[model samples]
Target chain A: MEQSSCTVVDAQETFSRAREQTLIESVKGGDTLAYHELYDAHVKRVYALCYRLTGDKALAEDATQEVFIQLWRKISNFTGQSRFSTWLHSVAANVTVSYMRKQRGWFQRMFSIDESEAQYHAAPADAHSIDLEALIVRLPERARMVFVLHAIEGYRHEDIASMLGMAVGSSKAQFHRARQLLKAWMGYDED
Target chain B: MTKTNFDDALKQQLDTLPEEKHPERDLWRGVALALENEADTSTAKPGWRSGWAAMAASVALIAMVSWYSLQQPSGPTEPSAITGEALVQALSQQHEQQKQALLVEYTDTPALADNWQQQLDELDDAAAAIKAALAEDPDNPALLRMLQNVYQQQITLIERVHAPKWQRI
Candidate 1:
């Protein structure tokens, strides 16, 4: 019975992938309806990544829109070397970062404004009830970005460094900083 | 929480994180609009080239308008000589004829921008405002100039977005 169930699961996975590949081909052929279907399939995952990276609902929404717009233009570039979800995530990360940079003022970009400290707000009524997502959002900008990219998104420190224009050491340090902050917010005792 | 316990808890939370999150509002509309705009432009020309063409057209229109304005009378004129209402009506008629001709010329060609109609509507609003101001000051050359400029912009926009690919070449 177990062996038969395993075979069924494998068969389902194969069917799902084949369907996705067909959908991708249809979208690349300039079928707007097929593109809409593709968007519906992946938008939630894209939106989640955007929201986690930006930590703002409205910014996430805008970034999601920009990502889809870019995807429509560049869908032909996907060679199917990797899973489509993986390619889409990379696109979302890059687009979100670029969108955030464009939203910043020239002065901020030029001056390299320090955003290392968390933006303060009233604490949750019960500290123990605070969720990990809330704590992640309270992290500083660079640390939050590094944490989301490296820890959650499973990007290597090297790739994170390149994406954020930082040294690998800096990316590692930011990840550590983010972990420490999250632990503290969660009421963990330091070793 | 102990360090070991915290590590375990963090790992569990990370593992359990939801893979999907839906936005409060539907974002498909904005994406569709943008894609439609891109398709409109990219079908006949590359997006970057279309952008450049639009910019060049704008500059040419500005230069022509400046040169023409320089040759015209600057001072206020008699209302009876050329009333603002009559000027608006004449310009509107000329604009409509030119617009129709351009539309017929490009009837088979796809537009270079999806929002061209929206842009025309916005220009129409501006012309109406200028018309209202001209009602109070029928002989204001400045008002007349503004009205003429708006009309010219409408015509320029139409010509730029609907220019056939052969002309671009």
Candidate 2:
């Protein structure tokens, strides 16, 4: 029965992929209805990613719009070498990171994590319950970017380094830095 | 409070993070308006290029028709030129006009990367620098490649936001 159920699940997944692929093709042809359907199917996941990366609700909203706009423009560039979800995640990451970087001034970026943290606008606090998304936003800029990408998004440190244009060591360092900061935020940095 | 280790707790929370989160607002309306605007602006082409644009359109139509027949019955398949239709037909004229339209449309759209305009301007400024260098050594292959790369980047920046395609897929 377990083996039969597994086969049924796999078949369902294959069916879903084929349907998604069809919808994607329709979207490529300027089919707004198809695009709308496609958007409906994926919007929440994309928005979540945007919010996680941008840290601000408004920015996430704008970035979400930009990601779909980009999708409308570059869906053709998606060769399907990767799953559509994976590919969209990559695009969302690029768009969100680029958006954040653009918000920062050239001189304010990444020479050191401490300096960037000073510029970072930490999230607002609550009296009793700490906010998860806000905690992420409160993280230092470089460390925040690294932590979100590495811990949450599952990107390798090397990949994070390349995306942020920092050394691989810097990416790893930022990840550790983020962990400590998050711990402190959670009232756990007892040492 | 139960003693949950920070790393373990955080890891578990992060791992269990849902794949989806509904935005507080509807974004489709904005996206739809943008798409509508692009289609309207493109169809209502600015004058000047309408001259040779006729020739370009004719060429693109013929190529698209050929490519369309070959496309799988599954929706709208990409044209023969996978990079783009213009790339497929080698119709630089049509591509240039489309590229310009996109550049104009996305001109005010803010780029999120730092020094976004500065970087684009730097690429443009490098064009002048290339021109000045060419005054000394006219046939340098490296400079030639740089010039091509710069133009391509400009198109990429523009199309990165507003390149349109036509197909069933």
TM-score of each: 0.62, 0.58
Write model 1 residue lDDT over A73-102, tens digit each, in one string.
778999999999999999999998888778
lDDT of 2 at B68: 45
What is the per-residue lDDT of model 2 for residues A82-130, given as tens digits with 9 covering 90 to 100? 9999999999899877776776663476554465343244433432465
Model 2 chain A weakest 10-residue run by lDDT: A118-127
Enumerate residue pairs that collide in model 1.
none
Clashing pairs in 2: A25-B169, A26-B169, A101-B114, A102-B112, A102-B113, A102-B114, B76-B168, B76-B169
In order, candidate lDDTs are: 0.76, 0.66
Candidate 2 docks with a DockQ of 0.21
Per-model DockQ: 0.25, 0.21
Top-lDDT structure, candidate number? 1
lDDT of 1 at B82: 51
Off by over 4 Å in 1: A106-128, B44-169
